[model samples]
Target: MHSKTASSSLSTSSRIVLPNDTNVLGNLMGGQLLNWMDITSAIAAHRHCGRVVVTAAVNNVSFNHPIALGDIVTIEAKVTRAFTSSMEVFMDVYVEHRLTGEKKKCNEAIYTFVAVDQNGKSIDVPELIPESEEEKSRYDAALRRRQLSLILAGRMNANEATELKALFEQ
Candidate 1:
């Protein structure tokens, strides 16, 4: 498989939060933001694999702040790690106030995707090379996250999670 840098697959999307995108409290709906995050992360996976990819799991998501109507919502995503046929994507969401030009982080999410062939079978993806310090950190942590996810899904036993075991042994 080919080796690709995380920056090569970086994706960013922005949308204006309209009235319809907000709830009765005038804040952007969590579902709507999740949908945006999913799409943005999917783009990053696609760019990395250059093959058809499908969302296998949404590992984690946090709605840290409210985004109001008229705010500009920006979502950034990049591939953090690639293993076999699956890749982990990390996304950060930010909102910019319309009037004050101030920006704040609103959400963060992690999504896992698997590359697939025409017949819907899993296909191997490229290795992700992390460049920046932050990217390297995320890349290293992906193993622990994957182990935890597998354990929680009952696909793997906690005792088999070597990376995760090391964390608590420290």
Candidate 2:
């Protein structure tokens, strides 16, 4: 398959936080935000490979700030790296102030997805090319994260994790 640029698979979704989506503290529920993020990230993965994708893992979700009810939340997701059949997607969650219209980044998340065929078997995905500096950084870091995940899952030995090993060697 041909390579695709990260920007090409960019997926964005925006929605207002309603009463049903919030907690007793009037803040948007984390699970609700995660659901939105999964859909957006899957869209990005599908756009990159043109096949149905499934969420394999949810990683690195950082809740830096609370999003109050009535705020507009925008989720932007893009493919950071692609392996044989899996892709690492990164998302930025921003909250727009209902009153001032100001936007601030409130959270970030990383998700892993695997492309599948109609029969539900794993399928190959195209390679991802990152252009911008931030994309490049995230793309490079994806390898290290993958290595760590594999090690923790007992699928990879520490000695075989060259990318992650290099980080500690430095």
Candidate 3:
């Protein structure tokens, strides 16, 4: 079966950050940022899988700058790696000043998704189509992230670790 591919820049999903999405300090809440990240990342996953995809894991999520209310929030997401029925997506969020239009990098994260069948079980995803050198670099990094994930999960063997090290060195 053929699967459709989709890609979008952070600006494409820009929305004004509202007070409700912010904290008492008038900055966007981390939780709210995460919610948007998950949603946007899922959009990329579904496009790659052509089916329902669930958040299996979020490896690294951190906010570097605060986004204030009235600022434009942009979240860019893309499928960087895929294996069997799972995909690893990388998302970066930015905030643009409402008046000046200057943008600042606010947050970045990596999420793992598993394509599911009607029964909610894992299913195979489509082949990824990397469009540029940067995209391919991100894909390779995601694979390294997956390897580290295995080590963290106590699933990595000595041979696997050696192979992963070699691949990452390239």
Q: Once all C-alphas are superposed, what RMSD does model 3 give against the true structure?
A: 2.8
By summed lDDT, the worst window of 10 consecutive residues in model 2 runs over 146-155
Q: C-alpha displacement of 55 in model 1, angstroms?
A: 0.7
TM agreement with the true structure for every prediction: 0.97, 0.96, 0.86
lDDT, candidate 2, equals 0.94
lDDT of 2 by residue, 54-96 (tens): 9988867988898999999999999999999999999999999
Q: How many clashing pairs in candidate 3?
A: 0
RMSD of each: 0.9, 1.0, 2.8
**Per-residue alpha-carbon lDDT of candidate 1 for residues 1-170, written as tens digits (9 for 90 to 100):** 77999999999999999999999999999999989988999999999999999998889998878888999999999999999999999998888999999998877899999999999999999999999999999999999999988888899999899999999999
Q: lDDT of model 2 at residue 103?
A: 95
Count of clashes, each model: 0, 0, 0
Error of 1 at 99 (Å): 1.0
lDDT of 3: 0.80
lDDT of 3 by residue, 1-170 (tens): 55433353221257788879989999989898888888988888877777899998888898888788899998888888778898888887888998999998877789898999889999988777666787778876777788777787677764576646887579
